[model samples]
Target: MIKVGIVGGTGYTGVELLRLLANHPSVEVQVITSRSEEGIAVADMFPNLRGHFDLCFTVPDVDRLAECDVVFFATPHGVAMSMAPDLIRRGVRVIDLGADFRIKDVSLWSQWYKLEHTCPDLVEMAVYGLPEVNRQQITDAQLIACPGCYPTATQLGFLPLLEQGLIDHRRLIADCKSGVSGAGRGASVGALLCETSESMKAYAVAGHRHLPEIRQGLSEAAGRPVGLTFVPHLTPMIRGIHSTLYATLKDPKDGLQSLFEERYKDEPFVDVMPEGSHPETRSVKGANTCRISVFRPQNDDTVVVLSVIDNLVKGAAGQAVQNMNIMFGLDEASGLGIVGLMP
Candidate 1:
């Protein structure tokens, strides 16, 4: 079994990783680190893993982690870049579920993340870890950059159009709504139960960090510079992301449904619902599934697409595990072939 280590394992994504990897047959959870919760029993912090993981949180020791077959950084944006370089040099495969290695341009990443990147050299080497688009690169990469929640949902919703040159890349807009858990397990006033329980509002509308990340992915698919107008909203729910994307169709011939179906024909995680079907976020909850449906407005030439994913699963931990499976030549669905739980 491949030994795995997770840095910053007390956070939502980290615990989510622990939940999934604990049962992963081909891999073993060797270590889970948490600076704040060091020396505390992980099960005490999250009772959900009581019997499964009896381990305690520890400090991040690079040497000890390097001994593992693979290491995952589920920390904040700047934390991974500082640690990934050292881990990669020790011949350890690293997958970062943070923004550190996701953006190819260090300058742009720094501008949005508000922190200077300590390792620019690794930026070019880190492969974007969207399995459907960058599968081969991920298989050969030592460092994989798992996508952001917003970007993952948005990119998957629109990639088929961009790949087929069916949309006007210059005029792309993404309006994504995510549950409160997407903000992480922090004690922010904005994320309090009373505050977000029954309200729905948009935050970071003008300059959300995911904007550039989405553009980068779309630009790569389009093979040209693409601009995006993105707005992110916080829904009152607990664990899903729904992205409604709009783009002008260059040619209305293939349209939305046919284009999406053709593009994701071989993808295991993505399920393109039938034409005119609407996918509910709860339908994809607790699983690494991205359900998509497309609609072409009768009068307008704009294509409307809806994409839903479990923010913590396909959006974070599950995707990180998916990258790990790809890097190790295991089936991408090795430990992730779980069906969604629907209410």
Candidate 2:
């Protein structure tokens, strides 16, 4: 069995990781760390895990984590970078579900995240953990940097167009909305039920942190620098991201649907819906899948693509487990055969 260790096991992402790993046939969760919640039983905090895990939360200890075959950092930014170098030196694979090593430019990452990066060298070495985009790199990487919730949905929506060089990369736009859980499992007056239950508002219009990450990925796909306008909104629901992407088509072609279908036909987690389908966020809720649809509105030069994903699943924890599966040569769908949750 692959021994696993998790750092910061109290947040929504952490517990979500625990929930998925508990059922993995080849995985044995060894250590789960939470500085503030140390000594508390894991099941006591999240009743859903009661019968699966009997372990207690422990404080973050690098030595204990290094003993495991792989360690996942589901903590906030900066927590993973502080200890990743040591773990990697000890020959342990590392996966970070934060913003630490996602961006290639350390200076830009620091400017957006507001903390100086601890390991600048690893920034270049860490593979971006999008299985559809970097599956081969992830298979041989020791450090994996998972994409954020908004970036996951937005990038998947825009990828097919950019890859074909059919869109004007300079005019790409992503108008995305996410559920309140995307804010993380934290206490904030703004996140209170009364404040968020019935309202929707857009934030980070001027400059959101995920902007640079999304731009980097799209630029790489277009083989040039991409000019994108990304705006994120908070919706009234709880666990998904819906990204409505707009791009000006350089060539008015009739094969847009075929383009998307062929591009993602073999990708396990990306579902390119039928020609006229509008995918809903709830369709992908609680599952590690991105449901996407493409359209040329009015048959004009403008194209619109819709993408949806469960922020905590395809966006965070579930993707982390997917990366772990790839790195360890296990079946990519071994512990991730989760059907979407619905009413």
Candidate 3:
């Protein structure tokens, strides 16, 4: 069994990791750290994990974390870059569920995050942990930087077309909407009940942090620079992300549906819904599933694809554990076999 440790166990992503890991047959949660909630039982912070994990959270210690076979950094952006280096030096594997090591360019990471990277050399060794595009790299990687929630949904929506050169890369527009939980479990005034309830608005229209990550992924897939007009919105719901992607098709006669189906035929998590099918956020809620549907939108030159996923699941924690399973040579969907929560 692979022994695992999680740093920053008080947040949404941390608990979600425990939720999925609780049922993992070949993995054990050996250590969990929460600087603020140290000594508090993890079950107290999350009643859902009452019987699964009876362990209390601890403060992060690199030496202790290095003892585990794998450590998951569920902390803020800068924490992992500092901690992962020591862990990696000790031959311990790491998966960061933050933005620290996602971008290859340390300057871009610093510019977007507004902090100088503490471990820029390790950035070259960290794999971008999107299993669909970088599965082999993830399996062999010592360090993994999981993609951000918005980028996860947006990239998956655009990856197939961009990789196959089916779309006009220069005119890509991704308009994404995510629930409140995407903001995290912090006590921000903007996320309060009154402020978020019965209201919806777009906050980062100019430039969000996920912009660079999305651009990087698409650029890699297209083998060239791909322009993007990425706009993210905050919805009133608690979970899920729905992205509408618009790109002009290079060939008006090429069947978009057939192209998407053929591209994703081998993928387990990405589900291409039948032609003309509009997928709902609830349809993929609480599962590591990305449901996508394609349309021509009255013009053969333009293709619109709708992608939906539980932002907290496929977009974050579930994907993290998925990366862990792949790294450990286990089935990618082992403990993540949650079906959508349908009413």
Q: Which RMSD values do the candidates have, in order? A: 1.1, 0.6, 0.9
Q: Among these predicted structures, which one has the highest lDDT?
A: 2
Task: Give the C-alpha lDDT of model 3.
Answer: 0.90
Which clashing pairs does model 1 show? none
Q: Can you write out model 1's per-residue Cα lDDT over 7-45, one digit (the tens) per residue?
A: 999889999998898788898788999988899998899
Between 1 and 2, whose TM-score is larger?
2
Clash count, predicted structure 2? 0
| Local distance difference test values of all predictions, in order | 0.91, 0.94, 0.90
What are the per-residue Cα lDDT tens digits for candidate 2 across 1-343?
9999999999999999998998999999999999999999999999999899999999999999999999999999999999999999999999999999999999999999999998999999999999999999999999999999999998888898898899999999999999999998989988889999989999989999999999999999999999999999999999999999999999897999999899999988999999899999889888999999999989999999999999999999999999999999999988999999885
Which scores better on lDDT, 1 or 2? 2
TM-score of 3: 0.98
Count backbone clashes in candidate 1. 0
TM-score of each: 0.98, 0.99, 0.98
* Candidate 2 lDDT score relative to the true structure: 0.94
lDDT of 1 at 109: 88
